[model samples]
Target: MSEAAVPDGRAAPTLTARQPKAVHSALTVLEAVARLGAGASAQDISRELGLPRATTYRLLNLLVQDEYLVRTPDLAGFALGAKVVQLATVAAPPARLASAARGVVAETRAALRGGVHVVFFAGGRLTVVDADPDFPLSDAVRLVREPERFAIGRLLLIDRGAADAAAVRDFAEFGATRQLGELAPAYGCVAVPILDGAGGFAGARGFSGSRPRADDPSDVLTVLRPAAARLGPLVV
Candidate 1:
């Protein structure tokens, strides 16, 4: 075999690549905190991330200061913070629904100046996977943990004549139907079902604006349906 000429007429030297400090440090800290989940102590983080104890403390302190992680009341352990919750609510993958629906949520928020929420059915409950700034109405609708009083979750179930059914059933119907809407005295919302590549329902994406503004469900549906349509195929 003929020997190949090296680039610039010189043989390439075997050398180890240098890791970028910022990127490496950030990733190391992130992995450490994630492995710790809701029970990570500073020492635990140091061991998990394989960094010096002082370095780990510095990184953890920075993360806590920035709201990426929160210390427990006793200050012995740490858990993910609200900012992380907010980010995860809008950026979770594997499920991939949040990422797929983010654009639609942004657009809806811009148009209505109200909250946009993406809800998912999990473990017999509806979880607010994502919520825009307009959410948790200040003077109007009071936020509740359960779905019964929430406009988005209730409408997703009841509007389809499946109010009494299981959450999974309602979600299934929602995915198959592609669109749903309802009017409430306090607030109103429009929802569209997202489906994956295999044509299975993934989740519900919707916009919650002022009740008076969303007076007509069809009007909101017009805006919401198209956005969901754009996202549905990309959920997988």
Candidate 2:
């Protein structure tokens, strides 16, 4: 809050002071839910913030109505909603690549028959480090907005342990994952994870093209594996 000093040495709120107690409490409720992850019940939030149970419920209802949060499938809890993604994380600016990283991306693109892209996972966010100039991403907006729909995004989810069982199995069996005709009809993408020296996930390198190419990603993996190793140090 902003305050103005009166002639009598008393403090008065400015006419343009920002949000009041209700607004602050509402935002606090949002932060609590986000920290609790999915399936955070009203009771959980009330206890976490030490707010009155009624107040927590009221704020939750308001947030859900405004689409800033959504009830889970069973309607027992809530998760951050699409509106938050659109406002906070959508279309993050592309990250710059070092000269050596650029060289690796160029060489990989030349060897592969499809689009080659690089993405980095940091701060629980995905950033496009590089996108193939010739093929450009098919749907750049959705790539960031809906990561679950793309292979590269799945890599981040898998590393975070938030991916579905199918993604987990695919990465275990093939050391890679692919999305076939999901992002666009007859088009698909395959992504391989990059591991740092300690073998933790660093990021991912992706190849996108026809569905057939994605179905048989062995060739794509061959080209991407060495490139990922080279990029591990440069990008991380």
Candidate 3:
């Protein structure tokens, strides 16, 4: 609220160079946390960015408060927050599906009793290529922001060899991952991996239905597996 008088008697706002420095420091801190993964301590970030210990802590707290960063489960360090994922989703467009791929999705939707969705893995991130309009995902934003919450996201995570025992177990039993009443109170989902021509993980095919069907997905997997195979080359 303070101002200094200009040479011509006009008033000029007083601004400190430190303000811009603070902005730079905050961005640097966020970059450090992302590079360090989910459990990057303040000390680690400080050293990585060559910033003062006090400044690193201050920026970390501010980022967390603004939802740009979040403390790890053990509260030991930090990780990229939901806001980052939301921004990334908005900035990056999903890969366009060819006509053949679209037909595969249409056929699957017609054969399936519930929602049929497709997602692809690109740049180490999951992109929802085709979402079922008739039965939309419970929360598409949350599905991408928090991958561990949906079976489709879990399928991608399992492919990455992440340390998720539950996702691994679901894949082993059903040849897909299952999410029962997790995304929503009454709905459930199952997702199977779609592999590329070379057998590399390309994407996932997801189906959402009632809780009972999700809990016992044997019948659903029968239909999903072949569809996923049919879709693999088309999408890739």
Candidate topping lDDT: 3
Off by over 4 Å in 2: 1-94
Model 1 residue pairs with clashes: none
Candidate 2 local lDDT, 1-236, one digit each (tens): 67899999999987444457788998898788767765689999999999999989999999989967777644888766646645655556546789998999899999996789888787667876676755656544357757888899999999888988777877897798889887457778989887877888878999988898888888788898888889899977
lDDT of each: 0.54, 0.79, 0.80
Question: Which residue segments of model 1 deviate by more than 4 Å?
Answer: 1-101, 137-145, 155-186, 197-200
Candidate 3, 113-221: lDDT as tens digits: 6889888876668887777766655555567768888999998788778828988988887889999986457779999989988887798999998888899998888
**What are the models' TM-scores?**
0.43, 0.60, 0.62
- Judged by whole-model lDDT over C-alpha atoms, candidate 1 comes out at 0.54
Best by TM-score: 3
Query: How many residue pairs clash (N, CA or C atoms closer than 3 angstroms) in each of the candidate models, in the order given?
Result: 0, 0, 0
**For candidate 2, which ten residues in a row score worst on lDDT?**
133-142
Q: Per-residue lDDT tens digits of candidate 1, residues 65-117?
A: 88666675347766655455555444333233455457666776676565556
